[model samples]
Target: MAPKEEVWNPSVETVTPVITLSFYFYPTSTTGVVIQREGFAFSYSEEFEQSEWVAYSLSSLDFSNRNFNRPFFIEDPKVKSRSADWRNYKKSGYDKGHLCPAGDRKSSYKAFEETFYTSNISPQLHEFNDGVWNRLEQKVRYWAKKYDGLYVVTGGVLSDNLKSIGEENVAVPNYFYKILMTKDGKKMIGFLVPHEDSEKALYEFVMDVNTIEKMTGIDFFPKLPDAVENKMEKSNDYKEWSF
Candidate 1:
């Protein structure tokens, strides 16, 4: 059978202000756009309405490996399940850490649980996710609270070579990345951090939306125009907006 077509439903916009700018939040994740103060603009994925568990089909984007070409469901569960190959990972002393925290997306419980998918996870040391990465995710939330709301996309990077752990297959990402846009749709900021823990790696770096596109091979904001992509790469001013 052909796959189910993803649909987006537009909702009212909510705007709130921060120190430098104001933000906007649409009730649903459907069609929305954000413009940054630095003059970069981006389109967001269609909001997953009716349910928080939106299936982002990896096949939809241009990202590298075909092995990762499957639909990923985002949900929030009380406890993350152990991977089939947990023993192998445990022997290596790594935990199936979540790149996108369940709490950050807790607009709803179901949405929160779906975020626990192993596909969306990476082999991370307990210290890194619990330490620096956790702090960063909190900062993003703080920014969201200060401003109206921020637009965000986060996930692990998968390398070309796929590895098998225990009985399940897993892919190691070269890096993990996240993109945040201010609410008013006027500012966009991108951050890339290595999968390993390092104090120096925590600092935020400037990124073009395309940088993520090139890495994930997924076209994040498919509804947005081409000009937004062009604008994001040229503007470095958004770097100053980082904390």
Candidate 2:
């Protein structure tokens, strides 16, 4: 039998210690229903009708130039509360933006297809999705190739006051964030970008993980040692990231 998965509580430590397939870099949950897929894992937010955060491991070997047919977005079967429907984005003037980008999972057809699950998507403006966000995704790929591998955690800053769309009322976030760390946890960087298109350099959006933690109430990389986590999360310096 599979090890029992722990349901984390944001208020206090309320989980049993059990080793699971989840990566050590996975973030803590604010909401419930943590879903682990073949390619990634995420915490589903029933209130917002989307994932609170998505995380996965990336490496040069994970990238393939193979062309695969794009799959239609569908509700994830693993979500106990049921993920939002893909139609929630249709005619809503927002794109069903991917949290675990399909490009990153192209090495395998199943991995790529898993990214289309609605649980791994968020409502995003088309321009923003195709513009700066796409640029950042490409940058992440480049860094993964350069660094050998990285652990990436990303998602929108979901809140109650944000605009909602479609019959399900999927919340559209005002900002999005991505945090990356080397496999050895020696280098870390975070970016917080406004939910819009801009020609600004990516480095200009750099932020510290500590600030993001406070905003999202998600404890990132909780498995790391306290001293290392504190030092890495407090630094916003991007000089080591090579832009």
Candidate 3:
């Protein structure tokens, strides 16, 4: 389901934290339990034992160029259904791949550390995580820098009877997908990538957001007007984004 738009009046007294402004771009969550964090928000899938999708804004101001020592993955306190354990990936021959990449959160130590939470990870091949996926992430950083900022949503395509790993039987998705758009919702792009390592250029995986929505049953960018949303979601034009 598309996220319901929340109108917050700053003058109104409220005890709860406001949802991040970026939440406007969140996709539909099939498995439910959407968790909000200071740095990002994600819809956790109890059935898959991982986030179905992680949504965050990448801002040019967020790249602080600071390096931090990696931290151990831990269960997300916000997830009502306990997130999968980091140990599940132990000797499982799959890397604990990050959905919201650590590199994107270097603006603060807390933001960087939040990416280590177990709910933010999925199983991935070593080469795939370090190679093609990494490449796509770098390209995103480039776009974020060029365009000032972007709303990004990413996750594996979770489904039934897939090869699973870990004591919790963490599902290893056959494919992963990412969608990005400017804050104004004028430009958009999506990529659906195979699970294994690949030498193919990143653009080769370029897909329209509508196709991905059909494949994953997620309604991306519901806040856009129907005219704009329909047109943007139907495009696979690589020229819109600079490589």
Candidate 4:
């Protein structure tokens, strides 16, 4: 967690546009600070010292395009309160989990590097982060490849009186959720996994998006036609989504 001794090189790529996602799903009015980095968008939570949710779109082409080395984690100076330091995870039995995963943004070095910012991280149990959580992230990439493109929204369930760590009192969520959908809204699925390790099939954690919305208190895809949104959110069609 020591500061880098060498000069850090920032990417020259232009910042990514904030135009792709529909306003219906962003919740900018009620959500905390909204920032659009190279590969993803996020609603950061000052109270929890991490993002409440991170949203990004993945395309099939990104899978094969490029790769880069991971840089040292850095505090997100853009965060008004200043992000938690990486040193907080030392001997903490938790991993500094990336909300907008680096793998999803490998299309550009800048995109990949932005993910290392501290504001995008939350404390996660080592077993859970490496196990089912990792598997689900891989699945999202697979779906991105199959669908050509997909929209993903992921985050931990933050709430009152959670166990905390570090001087920041970073909240440790007992459960985390991920919701994904094809760009056209023809197909969608949601998964809610407890913040613990398990060896079960991924679908075992699948639930309707409505269930997820209720559980998280954040409206997802509010811009879609109500009829389409209602139906998609209410249905958990596992058969339609290939593993």
Question: Across residues 1-243, which tens digit of lDDT does each residue of candidate 2 receive?
Answer: 866554433233223111112454579999867777778889999999999899888877567888999999999999888999999888888999999999988768888999999999999999999999999999999998897677889999987699999899999999999999876568899999999989999999999999999999999889777888899999999999877
Across residues 200-229, which tens digit of lDDT does each residue of candidate 4 receive? 999999989898888777887766667877
lDDT of 3 by residue, 143-197 (tens): 9889767788999998878898888999999999999987545689999999998
If scored against the real structure, what TM-score would every candidate get?
0.59, 0.91, 0.91, 0.88
Write model 1 residue lDDT over 9-94, tens digit each, in one string. Answer: 22333322121111222112223322222111222221211111122211111111233222344322222332233343546566
Question: Residue-pair clashes per candidate, as listed?
Answer: 26, 0, 0, 0
**Model 2: ten consecutive residues of lowest lDDT:** 12-21
Candidates in order have lDDT scores of 0.45, 0.86, 0.85, 0.79
Ranking by lDDT: 2, 3, 4, 1
Q: lDDT at 157 for candidate 1? A: 47
Higher TM-score: candidate 2 or 4?
A: 2
Q: Clashing pairs in model 2?
A: none
Question: If both were scored by TM-score, which would come out higher, candidate 1 or candidate 4?
Answer: 4
